[model samples]
Target chain A: MDSSSLLSRVRVVLCRPSHPGNIGAAARAMKTMGLSRLVLVAPRRFPDAEAAARASGAVDVLERAVVVETLAEALAGTVVSVAFTTRSRTYVQPFRTPEESAREVLQALQAAPDTQAALVFGNETNGLANEEVWQCAFPATIPANPEYSSLNLAAAVQVACYVLARTCEAFSPQAGAIADAPDFVPVSHEAVEGLIAQWLAVLERLDFYDPAAPKRLEARLRRLLARTRLERAELDILRGMLKAVARKIP
Target chain B: MDSSSLLSRVRVVLCRPSHPGNIGAAARAMKTMGLSRLVLVAPRRFPDAEAAARASGAVDVLERAVVVETLAEALAGTVVSVAFTTRSRTYVQPFRTPEESAREVLQALQAAPDTQAALVFGNETNGLANEEVWQCAFPATIPANPEYSSLNLAAAVQVACYVLARTCEAFSPQAGAIADAPDFVPVSHEAVEGLIAQWLAVLERLDFYDPAAPKRLEARLRRLLARTRLERAELDILRGMLKAVARKIP
Candidate 1:
């Protein structure tokens, strides 16, 4: 689940940026969120003095940034193109809250494991064109104040990248501990429900309770079962015992 | 849960900043992420022209920034103070995931709803002193590539502010939509366990199943409860049913 490798697959694409300074700031923003890939689609200025100056110490991000002639060129090999749109759009496009969008991004990485994804941002003043928004499979919107929802392009990138980084499964001391610990992930609800039905059959064969007066017994059992937080392997073991007991009966 | 109001209550405190440019960049970084309150503690240089140049158009954020003599003064009126550190520490300060720290910061805001909180970042070169870190209740470390993890002061601010902004409840279109949406929070696991123990007591008397051959039954039951993800009211309803069943058995 460690996502640093997955994070490497995420490209922060700034489309047709007007200000060199915003480009620089966006580079710094990307690095902070552990996102290094910066693909610029026809930015008005690149390799500009203003950009280098504004990049602060994250000049490396700018230096390594990929500048392409067109948005299509920028998203060449990318699978999921997510647009970071500011204004409300009449255009039809799949949308998700930034948090949920981050999850989707992670899942994309999880699904392919090696394939890449792109997060596209439109120009500062104009935002995304309807055509550009439609090009994306997913569009993520940041929840800012409606009255003054003026988030700078770099800031929008910062928020999205930040959520992606924060949501990432880091292989740090904390994540390492969680992985090493025996707190195995619990089994699904469907699996547990199936196990419960099987157990009921075994109980009926054993004459444990009169089936006619089972009043609240099954519900009580369900509630008790719900509390254990059982792992998949533990569920398997329990199911095995149920099968064994059922086989013993006539 | 648009947290713009809650964000304003956050004080981004920098202790002993050596460079004025970093202060400016940090201000810009904060503003991008919707965090404006800045407190400089014993900075080596303040109100310098270099800081203004670096701040870009976010000088308004810097113009309104606060400067104090000590970290204590910077943290004035702040009940929950978090220190951001880079190096691994053997010290006993409580550590939290940035996500968790943001939650704690939000809770502090909720506890008072009007009072301010602080996220304290260390100096550019040397980071916070041991004594300074101990002053804060929680400490959070960003998971970065250890090989070249020399994140600039402004970049650190950018990451932290981005996380805070992303996790906030903004009054924007998407935020309103999320707030209006019903996503019920489940009851705590401990509360579920206590109810199960009470039910087990009655089950013993009712001669439910073979007590001698528990046979992973209790384990299976616990798993089922965990899967239910029961709400408090549902737990209450089930507990009432358990009591009724116990009475009938006797």
Candidate 2:
């Protein structure tokens, strides 16, 4: 399952969110992580300017969001749902980290392509009640400060979406490879040997290399050259510098 | 070093942030992850009511935040800093994912307890300039959607802090263990055997078990019993149910 498809199977469900700005912020957060589905359950306000302003570029997510009257309706087709909560419950529910929950969700999506998963978040003030949490098969929590673990609703969504994106392999740092350096071709072994020979010749011309007392200099130079996974452009620069130095040696 | 102290040594630096609400949201994000120190580099507006309101319970982080005129000034004491950027730069800087960057930062903090590290975020509009990014030792980019990768300023901060908190083991889902279940004692071997015996006795009284045609039922029951790592309370419930059934069988 590719990352985006895996993420597509997952949805973010906000239950009884009071602040319209948080709804917008949550939309922006979800979109940034490549998650487009948003389900708002009984929100206090919708179609508000504050949410649109906060959503910034992700107002499309809000525009396409599904507003439901009940949490069950929001999670209608999900094969598995994770309740995002911090409150300690009386029931014996196993809680997993966001990373763990994401992995599980992705695994389920991969195992059964048609299955959907949901990440459910509660209101800003009071989190999901016990009855609401019971609807979810998995309960996940973010570890925060003991003194103050009050994570803003949108901030919590951002964290969960980030984890899901990372776990699904949707985005990676290597994805940001230098786009401008299109000509960064790796030099061959023979090319590296040629560059080393030229460097030694330059050093000999400059009186920097001595036949009488080489003193492991050639071997050390070879090790250094091998250590660097030189690109063709870099090899060219080094060879050019050596030629320039040799020409000026006289 | 402990997770809190390790997190305390790291600070968040927002360079040229334009929105006061973002500053407050960033502060809230940091506090939720057990981070306290915040440094702002030439924000467009500060000491604004919008920032305070957005900060929510994290106003203390904002109040104690250090405001500096220059990015260099903000990063004075940091041994290493990660420039968070999504821009395609002309320079050959390596971009790491947030998780990898967090591991690197935590490794540095653990190696030298007194040394400090910083996660630097760019402006809401243009992000960090190339010159500003060159000032940092490492550059990080969040793996976001290629089509719509504009993560909100505070949302980015939340993701970074959440990763850092997870890397430092500051908060974990296991920390939300059921606090009310104080008497969750593991059942003794003798108690489990006793319960099994009682259950079999009840089944025999009800004629569900036959001496001549056991049909591997006893072994199957034993296997089922071993599969469950029963608690004392669970064993008690089972034993009580078996006793009631046995009394009714007569």
Candidate 3:
């Protein structure tokens, strides 16, 4: 599908996954592209030891995964369904490429805000049967090397994720996209330095630091402030607290 | 721990997390506050059915989690480790509140760049044992509602994530921190108005605006530029080009 239609409101469904690792990887793939919903249908081993280990720290996804008995159960009340398949079939309904399928799904999503759209993939050994392919409005196929189109479950998910992430339009900031604008009032370098100086003055008055000694105390305070990157409001609060401390010290 | 020492250099680690979903959620929490580098010790389950479903879209973190076989493996080279435990210890090394613990971790991270410090959390059923707590330099207890401290795994992660995010000094543009003053130049509203007026003059010369009736062209341009809070350098470039355009307009 075109880039704009792949993000925001799509769910990736796995039917009878034999290996839990693939489920974990698929979840990871979905997250990288900002897609979250994952539905599993009749998995052999779920909450399995191997799956959790492979999922690494992504335990949240596993805890929330919905386990079901059948594809129909998984697709209950879904507005649109797109099936991912490798083999071409002449008897069944026409299948669209991933791009075309994504476009269709995107249109359906826009049309029906309340409805859910699912992209379904079958198990490792054998893919969805003829009936399952026919159940989908359109089949979605990933274009790969013609010589070897055997894509792993997670890899396929990643491809779909990449396509969808680019396609969807959302107001949220893109990953690593930093707008170079002065939107907020900044605590200027000069202001921070002044605050530090005032604090040092108080320390001196209280005889907390030896005047003859090296400027280690000032350097330490500077480093602390610099590393924290304190905001204007935060700095103001800190300065007020320091002043209070100074008042009590005398 | 003192406030300065409490917040020096901090790392948050999840131990034996049973669900991948929680891992994904944990990553989301960490990313929201600009914390990275998650370590996973021998989890009961990984890459499983439930995790992918629950993580929603935070898969990148799952993909990047450093998986290890043992707690020792996870803590191998770290200079300090804070085990998150809910259970009270009678005779263990001193325990600090989450605030104090967070401060200490933050300090360690800052004091010795080479020293790896971590805040470790145990499994779902039971938290880190006394022996496990003793493995670390200090024990950290989160001050929750007195009656209920039974925080969900992801919720615990979220709380720790928030503390680290707040305590750390890294100024992210996304977080609206003015850490890197050198990188940006602020542009004022008046400067933007001046540029627009100059542009309108050129448009008038080019007969782009109707003389008989005023069009909404300037309004539209203003709307577009208003959304973008330009840096000082950007304003200079735009104004410079506007002047060059005005010189050539005749």
RMSD of each: 14.2, 26.8, 22.6
Regions of candidate 2 where Cα sits further than 4 Å from its true position = A173-250, B173-250
Q: What's the CA RMSD of model 3 in angstroms?
A: 22.6
Better candidate by lDDT, 1 or 2: 2
Q: State the C-alpha lDDT per candidate.
A: 0.71, 0.78, 0.59
> What ranking of all candidate models by DockQ puts the best one first?
2, 1, 3
Please give, as one word, the docking class of candidate 3: incorrect
Candidate 3 Cα lDDT to native: 0.59
TM-score of chain B of each: 0.68, 0.80, 0.60
Write model 2 residue lDDT over B145-190, tens digit each, in one string: 8788998998899889988888878766665555533545777889
Instruction: Flag regions of model 1 displaced more than 4 Å.
Output: A19-25, A48-63, A88-90, A171-173, A176-250, B1-5, B19-21, B28-35, B48-60, B165-168, B172-250
**Candidate 3 ranges with C-alpha deviation above 4 Å:** A1-9, A170-176, A179-250, B1-250
Interface RMSD of each candidate, angstroms, one decimal: 11.1, 29.6, 24.4
What is the CA-based DockQ of model 2?
0.19
**CA displacement after TM-score superposition, residue A7 of candidate 3 (Å):** 5.2
User: For model 1, how does the per-residue alpha-carbon lDDT over B184-242 read when each residue is reduced to its tens digit?
Assistant: 32444345567768756655555554667776556545544533445545577567645
